[model samples]
Target: MNILLTGGTGYIGSHTAVALGQSGHEVTLLDNLSNSDTAVIDRIAQIIGKRPSFVHGDVRDTALVRELIKVHSIDAVVHFAGLKAVGESVAHPVDYYANNVQGTVSLLQAMQAESVKSLIFSSSATVYGVPQYLPYDEDHPTRAINPYGRTKLHVEEILHDVAQSDASWRVACLRYFNPVGAHESGLIGESPRGIPNNLMPFIAQVAIGMRSELQVFGDDYPTPDGTGVRDYIHVMDLAEGHVAALDYLNGRPGWSAINLGTGQGYSVLEVMQAFERANGCAIPYAIAPRRSGDLAAYYASAEQAHKLLGWSAKRSLDEMCASTWRYYQTGV
Candidate 1:
């Protein structure tokens, strides 16, 4: 299959590109390089032994997307292009809507124009808001707490409307949990511009001595460890989940939503311990006030994804830490 991946140079997209390449599929990476670097394409080529076709553009450029779809004979698309910082989204809601919401509309229109129907959307667990229940499933209600999550929910809603209006389109919305770690090769990983927003990246920076200390948020949560807990899935497994989603979309019909997670939750302190174990050094930390919109604890059921896509996250916390440490060591 000839697959067109939006935001293909970003963290998850880069790993998914490698997974798709290894799965015997032709890949065309479309990226604006807003939050990512072009040198990532070179790293991807080094890992996969074959570089994919690269396009420098935004998903909001409908004509450019249409031309690329027509020229590359793209069989499907995996949409991952968008601004994803939750706190930043609160301050810049319009930018979030424009990039994530309007971007999807443009991409869908271009797909419709080019007659490319299959799509795998990168949705988020944040769309569930605070997680009404532990181990959230596909049926969980969506109530985004922030503008970033609202953008994801909006795109998912748009995909549903498009699917209902057109019978030819096959769409799968993969609601991802906390995606962390890096490829084992240490050639590619996340490179946040400033202070890292996610736990794993921040922990990795601390472990590598790039940062001073970890701040454990809210040591009085309702969890066993008295800190916020989350499901951390390795980037490699998350990458494979995308491949599974694309493969399922290729053969299956209609619209469906699935959760990608390890079905396990870990607290902030537990992650610190895992990183310490992986790095062979103690990570210093202090308890801090909880972030404004953080949930007490939220993982995923993951059963639906296993049954539907034959996929389940398989990496341990140690593996997540070790792989991330390797990437940090080489400065990837």
Candidate 2:
């Protein structure tokens, strides 16, 4: 199958591109290099022995998207292009909405214009907002609190309405939890442009002497370690989940949201400890107040994912740390 991956040069998209390539599918990457590097395409080629065709453009460009779809004879699309930082979104809601929400609308419009209906959307567990219950399922209500989460929720709502209107649309909305780690090859990984917003990258930089002590946000949360807990799924596992989702979407006509996670929550301290164990270095830290809209603990049920896509996260916390550290040491 020929697949078009939006944001394909980014972290999860790069890994998924490798997975798709290894699985005997053709992939074309569409990215604007906003939060990623173009050299990643070569790294992907080094890993998969074939470089995916890349288009340097934004998702909001509907005309370019339609041209790419038609020119590449795209069979399906795995949409991952958007602004993703939660805190940044909180400060810049309009930018987030324009890139995430409006961009998705443009992509859907292009797909509709080209008569391509199969799509795999890069949704987020943030759509669940402050979880009404632990281990959020697909049925969980979407009360996204921040602008970033709200953007994802808005896109999900758009997809839902599109599916309801057209039974031919096969959409898989994979709600991802915290995605960490890197490919085992150490050639490609998450490379945030500025100061890392996520935890693992911050810890990696600190371990690699690029940064000093880590900041443990709010040790007063209601958790075992008094810090916030989250389900950190390995990037490779998350990548494979996309392949599984694509396979499941083959000839299947329906709209479905599935949780992609390990179904286990780990505290910030536990992650630091695991990183220390993985890299053989202590991550010195200081506790800070919790950020607004931060949840104490939340993970995924993941049963529906296993049931529908035959996928489950298999990497341990130690592996996630080790692989990430390896990539950090190797340098992308």
Candidate 3:
């Protein structure tokens, strides 16, 4: 199958490109190089032994998306292009809405114009804001708190409505948890520009001496160690989940929203300790106040993904830390 990934050069998208390529699918990467680096294209080629076709463009450009779909004969799309920082979104709601929601609308419009219906949207677990229960499933209520989560929720609703209006549309909304770790080869990893918003990268930077010390955000949550707890899925596992979703979409035509996670929640201190053990380095840290809208503990049911897509996260927390450290040492 021919697949087009919207943010194909970003962390998860780059890993998924390799997964898809290894699975014998032709991948055309379309990214604007906003938060991602162009060097990822070469890294993917190094790992897969074949380079994916890349377009240096944004998803908000409908004309370019349509042209690319026709030119590449794209059979399906895996949409992952958007602004994804929770704190930043809270500060810049309009930018988040325009880039995430409107960008998705533009991509869908282009796909409709070209009669390309199959789509796998990159949704987030944030949509299940402040989970009423411990583990969230597809049936969990979506009450996005921040602007970023709201954008993802809005796009998901739009996709649902599109699929309902036309039976020809096949949509898979994969709600991902915290995606951490790097490829085993250490060729590609999460390299967020400027200060990292995620925890794992921030920890990695501190371990590598890029940063002075790690800031433990609010060690007073109701979790085990008083810090917040989150489900962190290995990026490679997340990538493979996409491949499984694509295979599940072969003959199916409907909207299916599945959670991609490990079904286990690890507190902030647990992760920091794991990273220290994995990297054999002591990380300096200080306790800081918790950020607003941060959840105490949240994870996924993960049963739906295993039953529907035949996928579950295979990497352990230790492996996540080790792989990330390996990539960090590579300086790429």
Candidate 4:
């Protein structure tokens, strides 16, 4: 299969590119390098033993996307391009909507023009918002708590509508849980531009002595450890899930949405402890008050994905931490 990936140089996208290449599919990476480094392309080539074709451009550039599709004869598209900082999104809602929602619109239009209809979209569990129920499934209501999440849910709806308008479209919205870990090669990993917004990357920074300490938010949560619990899926497993989704769409002729998660929840303290063990050091930290929109507990059922795409997360938390640590250690 010839797969064109938007934001393919970013963390999850880079990993997915490797997975796609290893699975006997040709990958063409499209990225503007806003939040990621171009060096990741070389690392990806090292991982797969074959360099992928790349186009440096924005997903919002419809003309560029259409040209890439026609020139490469793309068979499918894995759309991972978008701004995804929750707090940042709250501060800049317009920017969030324009990039996450409008960018998706442009990509879809280009796909339609080029007759490249197979698409795998990157959604988030945050679309569930506060979670009216625990263990969110595909059927969970989508009441997004933040602008970032709202953008994702909106795109999911748009994809559904497009598929409905044309039966030739095949779309899968993979609602991802908290994605952590790094490639075992450590050649490419999460590289936030400034202060990290997510936990695992913060832990990695602290472990590498680049930061002072970890700040555990709200230790008084309703969870067992008095901290918020979340489903942290390894980036590699998440990448594999994208490949499976593309394969599933390859055989099918309709659109669907699925959750990509391990169906397991781990609290913040538990993750800190695990990282401590992984890095051979105690991570200093202080318990801080809960932020405005933090959830007490959120995880995915993943049963639908297993049933539909025959995919489930296989990496344990220890593996997640260890692999992430390896990436930071190698400093590649």
Candidate 5:
């Protein structure tokens, strides 16, 4: 199958591209290089043994997407293009809406026009917002508090409506938890443009001497370590989840929302300790006031993922840290 990845050069998209390539599928990457670098395409080629086709454009351009779909004979699309920063989304809701929400709508329209209905969306656990339950399942309530999350939820709503309108549409909205780690090859990984927003990158920078120390946000949370806890899934596992989702859409013709996580929760301190254990380097840190809207503890119920896509995260925290350290130290 020929697959188009919207933010194909970015972190998760790049890994998914490799997964799709290894899974015997033609991959085309469409990216504008906003939060990612073009050199990533070279790194992807290094890992995949051949360069998947790449298009430098925005997903909001309906005509361009249509052209790519037609020219590549795209069988399905994995939408990942968007502004993903939470604080930035709060300050610039319009950009978030324009890029994340509007871009997806444009992609759907282009797909509809081209008679391509299969899609695997890169949704986030943020769409679940404040956890109403311990392990968030697909049945969890979705009241996204932040603009970044709302953008994802808005796209999900649109997808549900689109699927309801057409029985031929096969869609999977994989709500991902904190996606960390790098490919075991250390060639392709998460490379945020500026200061890293996620915890793992921030810790990686601190460990690599690029950053001074980490901020242990709100050490007074009700967790065991008095810090926020989260489910962190390795990037490769997340990538394989995409491959599973695409396969599930082969004949299954209904919308399915699945969680891509390890169903395990680790605190901020636990992650730092694990990173130190993984790479044998101490991460300097200082506890700071909790960021607004941070939950104390939350993870996923991976049963649906295993039951539906036969996929579950298999990488350990040590592997997540080790691969990330390898990328930062050895990645070109």
Candidate 6:
């Protein structure tokens, strides 16, 4: 199948590109290179054995998206083009809505115009804001607290409504948890433009001596280590989940949201320890004030993903740390 991946050069998108390419699918990557680096394309080429067809464009360009679908004969779209920083989203709601929400609308319109329906949206676990229960299932209520999460939830709603309006549409919104680690080859990994927003990358930077020290966000949280706990999934595992979602939507014509995460939750300090053990180096740190709206502990229920898409995270925490260190040692 010919697949189009929006924002295909970014971290998760690049990994998913490799997964899809290895699964015998032709890939066309469309990215504006907003927060991503062009060198990622070469890394993906190294992993997939060739460079994918790339478009230097944005998803908001309806005409370009339509043309790509028509020209590439794109059978499915994995939408990953959007801003993801939570703090930045709070400060710039308009940009978030325009890029994340409105951009999706434009892509959908183009798909509808071309009569192409299969879509896999890159959603987030933040949509299930302030987890009411441990191990959030698909039935959990969605009350996204931040603008970035709201944009994802809003896009999910739009996809649902689109499927409701037409049974011919096959759509799946994959809500991802904390995706860390790098590819086993150490060719591609999370390389945020500036100060990383996520925990694993920040820890990686500090471990590699790129950064001075790691900031432990509030050691006073109600967890085993007195720090925040989270469900961290290996990025390669997350990439394979997308392939499974695509396969599950082959002949099915409906909308479903699935969680792509490991069912285990690890605390902040626990991850630091794991990385230290994996890399054989110390990651210096200091306890700092916790960010507001940060939850103490939350993860996903892998039952639904296994039951629905036949997918589950298969990498260990030690592997996640080891792979990340390998990628960093390459000076990527």
Q: Please give the CA lDDT of all the candidate structures.
A: 0.91, 0.94, 0.95, 0.91, 0.93, 0.95
User: Per the 3 Å backbone cut-off, how many clashing residue pairs does candidate 4 have?
Assistant: 2
Candidate 2, residues 257-311: lDDT per residue as tens digits? Answer: 9999999999999999999998898888998888877889999999999999999
Q: Write the per-residue lDDT of candidate 6 for residues 1-332, one digit (tens) a residue.
A: 99999999999999999999999999999999998888888888988898999999999999999999999999999999999999999999999999999999999999999999999999999999998998999999999999999999999999999999999999999999999999999999998988999999999999888999999989888888899989999999999999999999999999999998999999999999999998898999999999988888999998999999989999999999999999999997
- In model 5, the worst 10-residue window by lDDT is 323-332
Q: Write the residue-wise lDDT of candidate 1 on 237-303 in tens digits.
A: 9999999988788757688888999999999999889988987967889899988988999999999
**Candidate 1 clash pair list:** none
Candidate 4 clashing pairs?
186-327, 219-226
Clashing pairs in 3: none
User: Looking at model 6, which ten-residue stretch has the lowest summed lDDT?
Assistant: 216-225
- After superposition, candidate 1 runs with Cα above 4 Å error: none
Candidate 2 regions exceeding 4 Å error are none
lDDT-wise, the better of 5 and 6 is 6
Once superposed on the true structure, which residue ranges of model 5 sit more than 4 Å away at CA? Answer: none
Please give the TM-score that candidate 3 achieves against the real structure.
Answer: 0.99
- Judge candidate 2 at residue 321 and give its lDDT: 98
Residue pairs with backbone atoms closer than 3 Å in model 6 (clashes): none
**What ranges in model 4 sit over 4 Å off?**
none
TM-score between model 4 and native: 0.98
Over 185-278, each residue of candidate 5 has an lDDT whose tens digit, in order, gives 9988887878888999899999988889999889988889898999999999999999999999998887888999999999999999999998
Q: Model 2, 185: alpha-carbon shift in Å? A: 0.3
Supply every candidate's count of residue pairs whose N, Cα or C atoms clash at under 3 angstroms.
0, 0, 0, 2, 0, 0
What TM-score fits each model? 0.98, 0.99, 0.99, 0.98, 0.99, 0.99
* Clash count (model 1, backbone only): 0
lDDT of 4 at 223: 92
